[model samples]
Each structure stands twice: as C-alpha cells, then as structure tokens.
Target chain A: NAGVIQTPRHKVTGKGQEATLWCEPISGHSAVFWYRQTIVQGLEFLTYFRNQAPIDDSGMPKERFSAQMPNQSHSTLKIQSTQPQDSAVYLCASSIGLGEDTQYFGPGTRLLVL
Target chain B: QQQVRQSPQSLTVWEGETAILNCSYENSAFDYFPWYQQFPGEGPALLIAIRSVSDKKEDGRFTIFFNKREKKLSLHITDSQPGDSATYFCAANQGGSAKLIFGEGTKLTVSS
Candidate 1:
C-alpha cells in the first residue's frame, strides 16, 4: 500500500521563514493525523482530520501553526515565521476510521530551522 | 500535566532475554492502549494493542499485560533479538476520541 507518503523528507529554513509540510494519506483512509516529535516533548498531537473535515486542533500552537485537509488524498501543515523551537520531526498518520482504528505513520519530515 | 507516562527512559537487554517496558496513565477515561515501535529515523509503527476489557493480549513475541485498576500496562518482548532494539511508545485513547496521548517512550536495545 506504500503506507502514507510525506514529501521533502528533510527541510531546512531560516529562523523567520515559513515552512509547509505535506502528507499523502493511505488510499481509502478517512482519518489523518499530524504530530510533532521532539526530544523534550515526545510526540504531541497537533491536529487531525476526518473525512476531509478538521476534527480537532487543540494541540496546535495558537498563533504560528495551521493545518488543512483540502481533500481526502492529502493534508498540509504550515508553520508561519518558524522559530528554532519549531524544529522537530513532523509525522503524519492515517487510519481507516477514528477511535480504536490502527494508525499507520509515514517516515516524517525533519525540519531544521537555522 | 502529562496524562500518560512511561518508565526507564531507556533499557538494554541481552539477546534471547525478555524485556519489559512499563507505562501508566492518569486518565480513567482512557480505554484503548497501543504500543508503537520506532527506529532511529523512522516514524512509529504499531506493535501491539489492548482494550480495557482484556487483561492480556499477545502477538507472537510481544504481549501487553494491562491492569485497569492500577491504570498501568506493560509490554513484554520475549526472546528478544537485536532487531527488536528501538524506542517503544505507549499511547492511550479515550472512548470516542481519535487523539492519542503518547508517553515519553522507552528506548530498548537488545544486544546480541
């Protein structure tokens, strides 16, 4: 199934520049999730979408982070005016459905803000 | 406050030995628990999972022993091999929520 696919396996940007990460979910899956992994925070749930509609984004940073699932095939997470603290491994996952469903994750994009 | 927590941030065990990774949660609403294994540069993959209704769930060399009363669970990897070395994360989900609360993760290293 090729599982989930993430583009730009590695990304580097200036401290103030913006970064956009992409995720292509598994075909026929209805739920997509975004998570950020750091040495200090571990895996933090950033947001999620179900059937192309955003379900919850409570974990997203209030100002700089935003996510969108424009269609069933893909989702994007954008970080505006990125800071050094935003540098981390961003992971994307997809599931057949929500709640108790098994989530398959992509390799993730490693963002480095220098 | 972290809702889910894992112990022994890192562990090392000899090949053919059994490695036990422990986890505990503070939320009583969490009913579904899943363990994910991640290599150095890859995303996490589902290893084993258990529901609150069962006390034990096994899959090949991996098993989950859950204690609902204590709000704790442990993953037991028997006959461990070098390939089993990776970070293990314990995650929990509430009844109807899709969001998973992940623990700090335990890094396991099985030496040959």
Candidate 2:
C-alpha cells in the first residue's frame, strides 16, 4: 500500500501569505488526522475527520487555520496569512476507523514561514 | 490540558546499554497507550503499545511497562544501538475517542 501521501514535502512562505497543504490517505481509509510538530510544542493535535465528516477540531487555532475533507481520498489544511510563528512540520495520518486502530502517517509537509 | 507528559527531554546512552524513557498521563479515561519512534524528516511510526489492562508488553528489544493505577508508563530499549537513536513519543487514547494525545518527545542518542 502507498500508506499516506502528502504534497509539497517542503514549503517556504513569506509572512502574511497563505499556505495550503494536501493529504491523500490510504485506499479505503475512512479517518484522517492532522497534527503540527515543533521543537517547543512537540506534536500538537490539530483536527480529525471520519467518513468525510469532521469529528474534532478543538486543537486548531480559531483565527487562521482551517481544514477540509472534501472527499474520502483527500483532505487539505490551509493557513491564512501565515506568520513566522506558524513554522512547523505538518503531519497527516489515516486509519480504518475511530476505535483503537493504528494510524498510518504520511511523510509530512514542512512549512517554513518567513 | 496536556493529558500526557514525558520526561528527560533527551538522553544519551552507550551501545549495549538500556535506555528507559518515562511517561505519565492525567486522564483517567485513557485506556490505550502507544510509543512512537520518529527519525529525522519522517513521520512517527508505532513502536509498541500497551493496553491499560496489561502491566507490560514487549516486542523484540523494546518493552512497555504500564501502571494503570498510577497513570504512568515507561519505554525501555534494551541493547541500544546507534541506529536506535531517534525521538520517542508516548501517546494515549481515551476509551471513546480515536484521537491520540501525544507527549513532548524524548530524543535518544545511542553512542558507539
């Protein structure tokens, strides 16, 4: 299997610009998750979706961050007017279902906001 | 509220030595715990996991000792090698959710 695939493995964006990251989950996987990893905050849970519907997004910043699961095979996380503080590796993972299943992760998209 | 906490921001150990990384959790509902290993520039992978019902789980040289009552657990890597050097993270899941709360990763360096 291809596991999970994330696009633009590395991205550099100027401050105040928008950046969009994409994820294509494994075939037949119904659940997708997003996380932000930084040296200081570690791995922070950003959001999750099940069956193309959002389940939890409490960890996402209310102002500038948004995620969408428009179809079963893909999802996207977009940050508007990114700041230097937003620089971090964005990770996407997928699983079969919501209960106790192992999550297969993608290589992740590293965002560097200048 | 940070449900999980891990200790020793970083550790260095010699080959053939054992390295123990500690973790504690605050959520009583957490029933599943898993350890993940991540190399540079890659996503974290599952190392080994333990359910709250079990006190210990072992896979090859890696072991997880869990204390459900104390809400604490640990990962022990026996016979460490230089290739084993990476960041280890402890994660927990409550009974109802599939979401995992991760701890601040512990970086391990195994020297020759």
RMSD of each: 0.6, 1.0
TM-score of 1: 0.99
CAPRI quality band, candidate 2: high
Which residue pairs show collisions in model 1? none
| TM-score value, chain A, candidate 1 | 0.99
RMSD of 2: 1.0
The lowest-lDDT stretch of 10 consecutive residues in candidate 1 chain A is A64-73
Please give the clash total of every predicted structure, in order: 0, 0
Candidate 1 segments whose C-alpha is farther than 4 A from its true place = none
lDDT string, candidate 2, A8-110, tens digits: 9999999999999999999999999999999888899899999999999988999999999999989999999999999999999999887689888899999
The model with the greatest TM-score is 1
Q: How high a TM-score does candidate 2 get?
A: 0.97
Q: Once model 1 is optimally superposed onto the true structure by TM-score, how far is the C-alpha of residue B105 displaced, in angstroms?
A: 0.6
Name the 10 consecutive residues with the lowest summed lDDT in model 1 chain B. B92-101
